[model samples]
Target: MASSPTIRYGALAQTFHWLTAVLVVTAFILGPEGSEDEVFRGADLGRQAHETLGLAVFVLTAARLLWRLADRRPDPPDVARWMDIASKAVQGALYLLLCAVPLSAVIGTWLEGHPVTLLAGIEVAPMIAASHSLGERVSELHGLLGDTLIWIAGLHAAAALFHHYFLKDTVLVTMLPRWLKK
Candidate 1:
């Protein structure tokens, strides 16, 4: 639990936040090469790695969402009312994207009749019938969502920086690791 009403997040919440951020960023970086069929027609190492990490993102994000719902979040910073609303909206959008991007990829892969190899090499067979056209369309959407996620995540970072540098608030510091705290 937070030590004070507006103090730092619980350790578990902080862990989920940082872990999801890392996995999402990694999955985004590996997306292009991994989604390329030419790079690995029959599960190229890069594609396999991407799929594996994507699955992790999907699972982790779900757990994070659940944790968030069940836990008490720290109160919003003592910013203006509008800033608080904006913060909530942006945070909600980011969470939506965090869940959507990887799930879309999973569906696209399954629709293409490709099995996904999980982190431990556990194979997941495709559930739906193969459809090249539909698969391509979904894949395109997956890519588009990934791009959108990156942009929104950038905006989220910028907002934190704005709070940290301009407002000089704890909004950013609350999420920082202990060593980074002033």
Candidate 2:
């Protein structure tokens, strides 16, 4: 297939971006809101869904990063140098959080002497030695990171909207799927 154009992302990249967004949001919503004990109490459907979606996000992100290595991205829009730097920083942070969030969850669950539960009766046993106290701490960090991810993602979306409306540029449109582009 042809590489992405300087003007816009290819369909595959767009798909990866939008799908990851959807999965993250869905997983966040489904996450159980409670203490580590309550969250790991049982195999509830909501928790299972959240775990499954989180895993999907993690896997999707890994695939996206691999694809990024081989794919050509659209050129950055004309903007202030500071804006470019800020954008790059935000992008890097997002990628880091994408990996960290799920990893924290897995490590925390395992350390707490619990298996990472997913849908369809799939469970991943803990690979590390148990340390309940450390697990609790990591679980708390996971919650904080999850919240941070949402806030950062919101900021990212706001920036895209600003580019589309105020800057009147192709920055937002470039990542949009063909059907969504004008």
Candidate 3:
């Protein structure tokens, strides 16, 4: 919360953010294809792991939004207005996708008529679609949104690294895990 170059994230926020990032990267690396394909295209355990972690990402992102609102975030490096706008635009896009991608995914899965099992046997009620075409359409939309999210997140990471090294700023410190850096 301090308007200084200090760790702005609380313990809970940092833990959730880093852990979720790990799971997200793992999921992205694995891709969506499970062992079996063709008729039965279910999440399988690993993909379920991905989707489950996605839901957690949604929650953590929500928490981060709240934390950001509660505390004044430090500014990016002193730069040109256009550069700052670009940085803010990228961050805003990331935040929007972070929230939206999970929502669409959850809705699409439920519409496809499957119980979204969580860490154990916990499941959410199906948000059934009116028709198969409708379900597929929504699912397609979800996939597109997810792909866009990945691209945006890449931009986010690249910008962070640029700021940390080239721009010589403290921008990346808040998000780095404890052991990763001082």
Candidate 1 at residue 108, lDDT? 81
lDDT of each residue in 29-84, candidate 3, tens digit only: 54464222321264356556767788877887888778767764444457879988
Question: For this target, which candidate reaches the highest lDDT against the unseen true structure?
Answer: 2
Which candidate comes out best when scored by TM-score? 2
**Please, what are the lDDT tens digits per residue for candidate 1 over residues 1-182?**
73657556778888888887888788777765544466337545656677888888788888888887888866667788988898889899888888888888878877777777654556789888988679778888989988898898899899889888988888987777666654
The lDDT, on a scale of 0 to 1, for candidate 2 is: 0.92
- Model 2: residues with Cα > 4 Å off, grouped in runs: 1-5
Best-to-worst order by lDDT is: 2, 1, 3
Any residue pairs clashing in model 3, and if so which?
none
How far residue 139's Cα lies from its native spot in candidate 1, in Å, is: 0.5
Instruction: Give the Å error, residue 30, model 3.
Output: 4.4
lDDT of 1 at 91: 90
Per-residue accuracy of model 2 over 24-45 as CA lDDT, tens digit each: 9999999998777678787788
lDDT pick, better of 2 and 3: 2
RMSD of 1: 2.7
Q: Clash pairs of candidate 1? A: none
What do the candidate models score in CA lDDT, each in turn?
0.79, 0.92, 0.69
